[model samples]
Target: MCKNMKELQTVSERIFSLEQKKAQKKKEMDELEKEIKMLKNETSSYMKKRQKNELNIAGFTILFTAFARSSFDKDAFIAGESNGAELYRKYSKEIPMERVTVKVAK
Candidate 1:
């Protein structure tokens, strides 16, 4: 009977320790989520304020890229393009505006 009691106490202590660890992890996750939500909200607001370019315009078309050897994150440009649209959409919109044909030799 005494041996059994000792075993039970040991297990209870382990279980309690595990529960505390789990609670701490949960608290950390909640904090991270809150921070991300705040940042996303701020970025989204910027997107809303500006009128995204639906159609490409001749004057608006970049016309030509400097083509200088510089590396920038392509992903960021596509998502938050000049007028706030993808390269494909921006090019298509140019038809109505008769965009200036610029050679991109790179």
Candidate 2:
């Protein structure tokens, strides 16, 4: 028990100190949450930019392939004694593919 006024003052001071500490900690947590939110926004923006770029690249690849096929003889292009022919022969084999799609909610 706090027997004297000095002891009572000490207890009050301790409670005030603890409350200040708690407020400081709460402020720090709020700041950290704000930083995390900003980072998530930046990351989401970058991911959207990357997806757009990938779609553009896929479109260009399809257009280029169609143009090449129309402009050149397919058999000659694939079987010619050229570096491109060798690359096509080396890397053109089909492989099974799987992809996962992510949809963001509005």
Candidate 3:
């Protein structure tokens, strides 16, 4: 038990100080959580943009290759180089390709 008025006042002041500190810490934690959410949203937006750009590039490359094959002579196109040997375009063959796509829920 606090004997004097001064001792009771000191104890009350300490309790008030601790409450203030706890509130301050809670506020800081909320701000940090808000920042993290904002950053995650920004990251998702950037990833979508990057995926769109990559698909555009791939489409352009395929179109360019097809256009080149149709417009130019087969002898002029270099097909592949292996072991210091240069190979020219001879024929076209269809190869199976696997593609994966990601869809986001609204």
Candidate 4:
């Protein structure tokens, strides 16, 4: 029983340490993403001012392209079809999934 208890404690400690590391990494990633977004905006504005669609710097090529995105109009589809809801439900499927959540308790 003593050995089992020690093993359980070790596992718990490892989980707590991993959770703390995950949190710290997440914070770092968030900060990096913000910096990246700011740099991208600045670069885009500079490119626009110079009227350049593409740029090659340090062996990296960046291209700014404009395109249209088409999205389904749910309301329009439902209005146009007599049994839109039924059809939508028929095409949709429920996917079963499982997840494990770990946290460090304060």
Best by lDDT: 4
List lDDT for all candidates, in order: 0.52, 0.55, 0.52, 0.65
Residue range 1-106, candidate 1, lDDT tens digits: 3379889899889999999999999999999989866765554444345533232345433231112233444554565457645554434322221122323333
Candidate 4 structure lDDT: 0.65
Clashing pairs in 1: 56-93
Model 4 per-residue lDDT tens digits across residues 4-62: 98898998899999999999999999999898777777776677688777666666666
Q: Give TM-scores for every candidate, taking all chains together and pairing residue i with residue i.
A: 0.44, 0.46, 0.43, 0.60
Which residue runs of candidate 2 sit more than 4 Å off their true CA positions? 52-106
At residue 91, give the lDDT of candidate 1: 42
Residue 71 displacement (Å), model 1: 47
Better of 3 and 4 by lDDT: 4
> Model 3, 3-68: lDDT tens per residue?
999999999999999999999999999999898667655544554555532233323321111112
Q: lDDT value for candidate 1? A: 0.52
- lDDT string, candidate 2, 1-106, tens digits: 9999999999999999999999999999999989866765554455455553222232232111111122333554555456875656555544432222233322
Name the weakest run of 10 consecutive residues (lDDT summed) in model 2. Answer: 61-70
Instruction: List where candidate 4 sits over 4 angstroms from the true fold.
Output: 1-3, 79-106
- Give me the overall lDDT of model 2: 0.55
Predictions ranked by TM-score, top down?
A: 4, 2, 1, 3
Scanning candidate 4 in windows of ten residues, the lowest lDDT window is: 97-106
